[model samples]
Target: MKDLYARHRAVLPDWLALYYDEPIELTHGEGRHVWDAAGRRYLDFFGGILTTMTAHALPDVTKAVAEQAGRIIHSSTLYLNRPMVDLAERIAALSGIPDARVFFTTSGTEANDTALLLATAHRRSNQILAMRNSYHGRSFTTVGITGNQSWSPTSLSPLQTLYVHGGVRSRGPYAALDDAEFTAACVADLRDMLGQSRGGVAALIAEPVQGVGGFTSPPDGLYAAFREVLAEHGILWIADEVQTGWGRTGDHFWGWQAHAAAGPPDLLTFAKGIGNGMSIGGVVGRAEIMNSLDANSISTFGGSPVTMAAGLANLSYLLEHDLQGNARRVGGLLIERLRAICAQLPVVREVRGRGLMIGIELVRPGTDEAYPQAAAAVLEAAREGGLLIGKGGGHSTSVLRVAPPLSLTVAEAEEGAAILERALRSV
Candidate 1:
């Protein structure tokens, strides 16, 4: 383990953060459990940052990937790939956008990059609006639009990005307001931001639930209200579903559906779950917007047959098993359990999230000061107790992120919760 860690530090970039004081080397996984190289088994609550949508090593996805690989693996976007076409067709239908067209990518960053491309080119504007305390992706262009200063390295970007309000509902300046008034205040703020833009704003890109900034979300219908204002300005609304997509939110298939009154966003970006550990990401948007690029473009590994097959199978499994319903039912119980436990803990500030995507904000015992130390301690304790979780949030990484696979069982949930309870107490 020491040798591996030394080698990793020597070979990899320093910014690529690894969890734990002693980073783990995971070997294999089955269902909701994974074993490290040392042969220690753990209940995987993070699911590789929630990429493993279904269970680990799900036979259906495994078979699909293996079969596709045996037949063919790399047929770039230049060819007519059946798996890609089939998956695209399915996604287009599922995507609420009318006359939708799907463009495949290999990561959430690339998908969001494509969405920005389409939006900027279609609107003939390079101005963008993003929510404060939100995270998009790690890329030259994506970092610019990212509202989280910790994630974004540089302010120099191709597009002019204006940070707006309404991402975090509980801790921001408008936190004290009620739902309706909060929504109105954010809409007014958005309108004011647009009015200050030098030219027409291309689009407003937002995450239904801010993931890396913690599982923080605004009041329901806030985006719908914002959408109404954006529409009046001929600005597009782009829903960044990288972390919140694939029924993780429990209450809705897509997090954007919570604000369905304004209709679907003009464009939607998805990743992290559809591939079930395979690399798959995409953007679904109206045909008119998608076709705005005058020049030709293609991604060499985008929509590869193996990944597409994995995605198709995974998506099928999710729908067939009614994982959304499971998320709603099981997640409700998990949240209730966590909330009940957290109410008695002074270090815990809040337990916020929907369904499987839950976050526990840590604060100083008797004060509201963000307590990153407690979060770190709890994370280490959880691992020691054979439970693996994740950490996020903008408050110096003071939020514990708990998101397991969609197929997580009731017993597994209870086990995880118990382990987490002990970990929190130990902290």
Candidate 2:
């Protein structure tokens, strides 16, 4: 294995250092468990940073991909494809957006990049406002708008301005500010920024629930108020649902539905779970806004037949199995268990997030400062205990994010939580 790694490293580009490869070489996975080459089975609680909502090697999705591969693979985006059209229609219908326009991409970053471009093109503006600590994508433009400076070393273009806002857990009791006060303050800030930019603000991009920004859920009524402010400024609201979409959020098919009366975003970006590990992503937006782009404005491997087939099959499985309902049930159980465990542990600061996406924040015993080392120790201990998890956020090396596949069983959830509790105690 070491030799294989050395060989790959010799041939691969040095820039591929973004991921820290584990010692285990995973051979296969089923449900919520993955096996390494050594036949060691590990419970996967991280779910590829919330991408594997349907779990690995799902039989239905596998069958669909296999069948599609036996037939046609790629088709030019210039022509209409049945699978692409079907998946688009399904996404629109499920999202409650009538006559929504869709544009496909190969990954979440591309989906976000396309949404940003479309928003700017539709609004004819050069400035973008993003939530601080929010992560959009790694592309030049998306990274320019991403709120975390630690993730980027390149100098940002003057066209982008990020508003660093506090997350619910980070803001403590103040996290639940009154809707009117929160709205007024956020609107005033944006208004000032817009004035300084001479009305060049194109869009205000956010995550319905911040994924990498510590799995933070916004306060109640925040989304509606934020949307109103954006509407007042003629700016588009782009919801980056790359990590939150595809029924992972439980109550609704989309994470934005958790916002309730906050109203829908002008544009929504999705990817990750849509294809069940296959590369597929898309942007869904209001018809008028999506149609503003030229006929041939954007083109690439957007909606290939294979990816579309996988996406369609994945969606079908979600609906047929009622995975959204399962997410809610299992996620609620996990959260309740974690909160119960936290009640006895002073080091456990907070357990926040909704549906299948949850984060356990580890802080110092008597200080507000995050205890990143303790968090890492917890993760290391979990891994030693045969469970897998991941970390997130700008200030959250302290956050252990748990986003298991939606199909995870109650027993599996209990087992994972038990292991996690043991790990925390050991750490």
Q: Best by lDDT, which number?
A: 1
Computed on alpha carbons, the lDDT of every model, listed in order, comes to: 0.93, 0.80
Best by TM-score: 1
Candidate 2 Cα errors over 4 Å, as ranges: 13-22, 164-169, 172-184
Q: What is the lDDT of residue 364 in candidate 1?
A: 94
For all predicted structures, in order, the TM-scores are 0.99, 0.93
- Candidate 2's TM-score reads 0.93
Measure candidate 2: CA RMSD.
2.3
Model 2 Cα lDDT, one tens digit per residue, 99-215: 688989999899998888788888888778888778888888887887766555576654566573533435633455575565556556656666676665788888878888778
